[model samples]
Target: MTKDGVDTSGSGQQSGKPALHSVYSVNNILHKVQILDGVKVTYSSWVKLFILYAKGYKVSYHIDGTKPPAGTDPAYAKLCEIDAHVLQWIYGSISDDLLIRILETDSTTYEAWCRLENQFLNNKEARAVALEHEFTYLSLSKYESLDDYCQKLKDITTQLNDIGSTVNDQRLVLQLVRRLPVDYDTVGAYM
Candidate 1:
C-alpha cells in the first residue's frame, strides 16, 4: 500500500509501480490554490496556479485538450479514471456561483477548462476598460492604511498588464503619486 492505503503491488501490471489512481492526492491541490472567486483572484493567475498543479501531478493532458485514447485502447480506462479526478479538482476549487454558471453535464476536464476561460477572458477589451476605470477610481483616502492602498493599486496594474493593457512604470508612478492623500504632499512632491 502507498501513503493513502491503496494497494500498489502492481497486480497483473508491473512490479512495485503505483497505479494511476494511487499517484494523485486531492487535498494537496485544494490547499495550495485559493478558490477562484473572479474578484479576489484574477482568472489568469488562477489558471497559472492550476496549470502548475496539473503539470506537477503529470495530469495536465486532462486539461490541455489532449485527445484521450480510443475506447478499445488499453489505456482508455486509466485516462477516464484520472480525468474524473481532475474534474473533481476543478469543481472543488471554484466558488459556488461560478460553479453554477459553468457547470455542464458529462463534461470532460478539457471542456470545463475551456468554459471557464471563455467566461473570464472572452471579452478582454471590455474587462480592460473596467479595470482601467477601477484603477482610476482607487483613492488613498478611501483606505485607512497607505500600504493597503498601494498594494491594491499594484494588483490592479498587474492584472491590467497581464491582460495586455500595458501600464507603464511611468504611468504607474504617476498614478501612485496622483492618488496619494493630501497628507503625503511632501512625499508626492519628492516622487
Candidate 2:
C-alpha cells in the first residue's frame, strides 16, 4: 500500500513509477443508484443521464449494443465477464414489468438496452401530443413572474424539440405575447 493507502501490487509498474489507482469503483457507485420507473414516461434527459452514468463505469458497451468477438484471449474473456456483470447491474436498475418485456426478446445486455430505448424513447407521437397539450394549457398565473413564465414556455419548447417535435421561435414569441397578463400590457406593447 502507498501513502494514500492505494494497493500498488500487480499494477504493472516498473522503474519505481507510481502505480495508478481508480478513485472510485463503478459498481460501488452504481449499486446505490435507483432504477427508472417503468410506468412513468421516461424523458430523454433521464435516459441520457443514465447513459452518462454507465459511461463513467466504462460499461457503455452494453448500451451501445456491441458484442465481444469470439476469441481465446484471456483479456477478451475478462471483458466478457465484466460486460455480463454490468448487464446484470443494468437489469437490476429496471422495473420488473419492463424487465420481463425486454427479457422476452433479448438475451444480451446490448439488446436489452436497445429494447428499452425503443419502448420508451421511440414514442415520438405520444410525446409530441403530450408536449402540445402542455404548451396549449400553459398559462401565466397572477402570482407568477414574466421571467418564470417565459422560462416555463422555453422548457416546454425544448421538450418538444427533444421528442422530434418543434415549435418555431416566432410561434413561441407569439404565444408569449398572447399569454401575457393585462398587468404586463405596457411591456407587451413595447415588444
Candidate 3:
C-alpha cells in the first residue's frame, strides 16, 4: 500500500506492461455535479456547470457535438463508454415527465441535450414576450423599497438578456422613472 493507501502491487501492471494513469472517473465527477430538475430558469446555468465539470474530466465531447469515433481503438472505446455513462446520468437526473418528452429518435447524448434545450431554453420569442409582459405589468408595492424594486427590474432585464433579448439602458432608466410612485415625482424629475 502506498502512503495514500492505494494498493500499488496491481496498479502498474496491465497486460504485462505499465499502465498510464487514468485521469477521469465517473464517481469523482458525479460527486460534484448537481442533478437537473427540469426547471427552465435554472437549466442554462445547470448545463454550464455540468459542461465545466465534464470538460475537467475530458468528456465534454459527449455533449458538444463531437461524435465518438467508430471502431476498436481502446481509448476511443473507453471514451464512448464514458459518454454513454454520462448520458445515462443526465437522463436519470431530470424529472420523469421531462425524460419522457425526450424524443425516442435522439439516439445520442448530444441529440437529447439539444432536444431539452430546444424544448425549454430555445423559446426566445416566448421568453421575450413573457418578459415584456412582466416588465409592463411590474409596479412597486406600497411596502416595497425603491432599492428592492430597482433590483427586481435589474433581475428581469438580466433574464431578458439571457434569453436573447436586451432592454436598452435608456429604456430601463425611463421605465424606472415612469414607474416610480407619484410621491416621488420630485425625485424623478431631479434625476
Candidate 4:
C-alpha cells in the first residue's frame, strides 16, 4: 500500500514507511481506489466499505499491507475480498472532520456529496470543508428523533461544530436539545 508517497510492501515488514507522499484530494483518492480489479464500486460502495473499516472490521494486512476486512457482513466481505485494491488506497491525509461528514450523511446525501465532491475535485478545488458544511446541515436538520440523529452520528469519531441551519435561530445546540428531548442518551451529547 502507498503511504506518504513511497510503497510499503506490508505493515510490519517496515517499521516506518512512506506511501503517497501526502494525502491526495478526496476525488483523487477515490479514483485511485476505484480501479481495483473485480470490484464494481459505486460511490456508495466505497462509502459503505469505508464505514465498515472505520468501525473496525476484522481483516488481515496482505503482503502489500492491504487486505479486505474478514467476516464483514457477507455481502461486503465478498466485495472486499474480490477487490483488495480499494483497501490499498488509504486516507492518511484527509481530516477527521471530512471523514465525519461522510459518515454522518444518509445514503442519499452521501451519494450527492460524492458527485459534488468530484466536481470540486475536477476543478482542482479541495473544498472538503465547504462540502462538509453543506452535508452536516442537511443531515442534522432531517432528524425526527434524537435516536435517528444519534444513529447517523454515532460512528463519527470526529467532533463537528456550528452545523445548524441558517434558518435556525438558536445560539447553542444544548438549547435545541433541551427543547426537544425525545431521547436523552442521544441528546445529552450536545448538552
Q: What clash count does candidate 3 reach?
A: 0
Compose the digit string of candidate 3's lDDT tens values, residues 68-159. 67677667866656667677756766667778888465367787888877766677899889888887667777326998788777777766
Please give the TM-score that candidate 1 achieves against the real structure: 0.84
Q: Give the poorly placed runs of model 3, Cα more than 4 Å off.
A: 1-41, 92-97, 103-106, 142-155, 168-191
Question: Backbone clash tally for model 1?
Answer: 0
- Residue-level lDDT tens digits of model 1 in 1-191: 56655566644234446454543656555696879887677677789999988888788898888889899999898788888888888888889988987899999999999998787777889989999999998998788798888888888887787678989988988998998879899999999
List of clashing residue pairs for candidate 3:
none
Computed on alpha carbons, the lDDT of every model, listed in order, comes to 0.82, 0.68, 0.70, 0.37
Candidate with top lDDT is: 1
> Candidate 4's residue-wise lDDT over 53-93, tens digit each?
43342231222234334555654654444234322343222
Which residue runs of candidate 4 sit more than 4 Å off their true CA positions? 1-127, 139-141, 155-190
Better of 1 and 2 by lDDT: 1
TM-scores of the models, in the order given: 0.84, 0.59, 0.62, 0.23
Q: Write model 2 residue lDDT over 1-191, tens digit each, in one string.
A: 46765556865455556533232345443455566563232445556776777777666776785767767765686666666666676677777777777775326677777787776668889978987887877778832577888887887787787677878998898788787879878877877
lDDT of 3 at 62: 77
Cα-based RMSD of the predictions, in order?
4.6, 6.2, 6.1, 16.2
